[model samples]
Target chain A: MLKDGRVFVIPCSGIGKALGTVGRAAMYEVVEKLRPNEATTICLPLLTIGDEAVLKLARNNPCISVDGCPFQCARKNIEASKGKLVASFMVTDVLRENKDLKPKAVTELDPKGLKLASILAEKLATQIDEINNNNR
Target chain B: MAIVKDKVGVVSCSGEDLPEGTISRIATRIVLEKLRPNDTVTICLPLFLAGSEDERAFARVFPTIAIDGCDKRCAEVGTKKYSGKPVATIVVSEIMQKYPYLKAKSRGKLSAKEKELALKVAEEIAAKVDEVLERKKRGDSN
Candidate 1:
């Protein structure tokens, strides 16, 4: 099992657009900064390829997928890998909610992009806390 | 160097099926995180393949280096298909051929040999970045 009863985070390994980077930045914030003890991450591509250890972890732990677009590659891969997805987030939804934050540059996010990532991270953190509380 | 305005885009086939794929990802990270942090930016392969106009647009504007793990050349082919042809391409399998002693034990974790291979590939990528930047500078000057 994962240490500290943390949730697994799967970010869409979508490198194509600013939204994809936003999803990845938000996932990093949730896993490495905001909820370091409460969340971990599995590479989405590895899960797709059926990595045994990642599959086992997914089967055992609840996961949250952060997808860049509507396709929800992270969510689909998690389901395909036999992992339980407790909650999911979409960068497009976040952008829709926060219309002011128009991120520029797919590879290098501008300041607005970082702000958007933080906002999404905070939302994800709340969802993770809710899952933990319910489990407890 | 007169403050190059654009950074090189680094796209790797972060394929999970093979150890070479893992090597490609690790090596890309080395370039992004350690080697040429300011000179290169990573473009996600999945999004690029899945029709992200933003990624395709960025590749068209910036010089891109596609790093492939295997002979399938998914990264190279995908970049060329969606965006323009990459400025340079690096295949991990070709790198492996050059350094047969370095081997990756698993797709999930990098063995010592794999780490070495990743470092070697990263250095090569860094060199490529310099070469691309040099070409760009020359083109701009001309």
Candidate 2:
């Protein structure tokens, strides 16, 4: 079962960008572990531009956004471009699940965070897989 | 008159308390070690925003290099906001892009090669600092 045929890992590249560290980890989960057919990471610039090529590529497909924090810049960028977002995964939620993971420590990508990201990616991928399968 | 010492500062978004990537930690340490007797070095992390009057302590330094993890530019922008001069900004992605060989197994872990490249970027930053200081001195003499 596939939920959506296309998936986009979009993060805000603003001055407060947190997704690169966290959301990026999640993207790896979806691509490597979950094995999605189409998964691409788009920063603020792409969405901000709303290029015709990008817009057309996404016009027929549903999008799932992964944001690093609550700012929702990823979702906002999509809306600003008149695009629809099927779902969103906020990284803060993942961080909350793992209390042992400290935000203060700027450690390298820890296995715990990776595990958490993969868990979320799994859920998202499963949902997408189901949705796509049902539509067929 | 007291001799004015040139200052070098290392700033990262991952607060001073947290341990960052091997390149960040190791490269920063190397930069500190290379400092001359007349040079001062500051290692700051973004978590210092919670500290009272910490901004004042930061502005006193010069040639600040912000080592941001991603494009969010937290350390780079914060240094500018606090009135601290940012001589250079290094984003980890830019460094990784320079050395495609540093790509991690999965975006979650940095490969050993990536760490080495990070050290190289840090060295470049140090070289930039030296160039900036020398340029400043020349301007001062004019």
Candidate 3:
């Protein structure tokens, strides 16, 4: 385990839309690429199941919720588990801003979907830094 | 309320740690979108376990097919916990056992082999959907 103070990036695994897959891809980009040391993720389903270790990790650190739809399952799960949410993103809202990016597939992202995820990942990385600055 | 006669709830676990988890998710989408578009609706597992009353209600009332990635079976467990027992459960690991060559490695993007495996799994889920729907009179679409 990397030392304490990592942000938990919770992405909604909503299978209904391509946007949710984009959110998941964006999450992987943030934790695995953009801010590897600063951010980590636990499956949202694990948090909902009250997995003790996952709950501890979530509760101990700041969380960023990336939800695909308005239902906001990721954010609500964090709140339900009493995890601190430092930032929340709606993939639909992001797509609105970057209208050129279109995610077409749910299984694996197409070129445009990967681009959208990168955009979202870059935004989350920036926010994590800003949050760190504020905390300091 | 009563179980919806026409629709089945498909709850697929989102297991991020393993590639099988990814297969479970992608396969679910294929079944919902490509294979059984009109007959199945997705029940987001995260929302379901997070005490979304509507999700719970749907699983409780509708014929639910829980698709899980690993032996842990989060989807099956969650559906059984909040709602009634799922009408059926599909585990990807078990399915993988039947065809060893269809192994998937990446969680982010699927290879062609992985896509084929996902299609096979999707077909399995679609079959289950048809079974639960009791569609003996109707012809299978794909």
Candidate 4:
């Protein structure tokens, strides 16, 4: 069974910084666990490549972009695809709020990094619920 | 005066949807941070498409090694379209043939075998970076 509301969670997945992977990990938590049915993810590269199927997903669903850095690639790509953005987040801000937690790896996150992902996921989940409620 | 060495850009596929994508990112990170930190810099694929001039300019002026998770070669394709052609492109799926035992099963968490495979891939990227930089030293066109 699937949930009622729909939103796309797009992570920048930038390999330049550790935060990129953290942001991606957080998005995974949001779509795969927290709001499984309400949110999903698409390949940002595919959308950039002008894939028709992916373009339709962006056109129809509201998007929530999570970026690891100031580049905001996911958010930019979504806008370039003409996708709608309901809300956006920065993993750095999440990290800023949790001064105690520090993420150190870009490839595979450490324990603290994983915890950071969870914290960011929880925040995104709350935003997702509000968007879902508003849409309803 | 200190001699400034040319730097190489490593562009990895965003690979948001696949386990192999996870492997590709890990391998690229190993190369950038551990193996050739001084010689290489990361070029985010999303940044290329999202209109980051600095990344595109770097790829155009310098040699780039595109690492892709699958045959789609998203990183390589994007690099070529936005900037210049990358000097080399490595696809993780092709490398998987050598490590039949490694199963990259999760995006959030990688299996031990997958971690080993990532190391193998990183070694490959590291070697390529060395090769490209050496060529630059030899006055070859990227």
Could you give candidate 3's per-residue lDDT for residues B25-138 as a string of tens digits? Answer: 999989887899999988788777554576678776777899988887888887787776887899999999888999978787788999999999999999998898884235
Residue runs of model 1 more than 4 Å from their true location after superposition: A1-4, B1-142
Comparison by TM-score, 1 against 2, better one: 1
| TM-score of predicted chain B, candidate 2 | 0.69
Residues B1-142, candidate 2: write the lDDT tens digits: 2223366566654321112332454455446555332454653332233234644356444556776655656567666665465777877667767777665233345466655665676676677567767766776421
Residue A43 lDDT, candidate 4, scale 0-100:
81
Q: Tens digits of per-residue lDDT for model 1 on A74-133? A: 887787677889998999899999999989865446899989999999999999999999
Candidate 4: residue A74 lDDT (0-100): 93
Candidate 3 off by > 4 Å? A1-5, A132-136, B49-52, B135-142
lDDT of 3 by residue, A15-48 (tens): 8788998999998888878888888887777777
The candidate maximizing DockQ is 4
User: What would the TM-scores of all predictions be?
Assistant: 0.58, 0.54, 0.88, 0.90
Q: Per-residue CA lDDT of candidate 2, range A1-136, in tens?
A: 2323465555432222333355655665665567556554433333333446556545556666666655565666566566657777777776677766533313344566555656667766776676567658
> For model 1, what is the alpha-carbon lDDT of residue A74?
80
By the TM-score metric, which is better: model 2 or model 4?
4
Superposed Cα deviation of residue B142, candidate 2 (Å): 16
lDDT of 4 by residue, B7-71 (tens): 88888886887888888888988887889988988778888777657666767776889999989
Alpha-carbon interface RMSD for all candidates, in angstroms = 6.1, 10.6, 1.7, 1.1
Cα deviation of B61, candidate 2, in Å: 16
User: What docking grade applies to model 3?
Assistant: medium
DockQ of each: 0.11, 0.05, 0.53, 0.74
Provide the DockQ value for model 3: 0.53
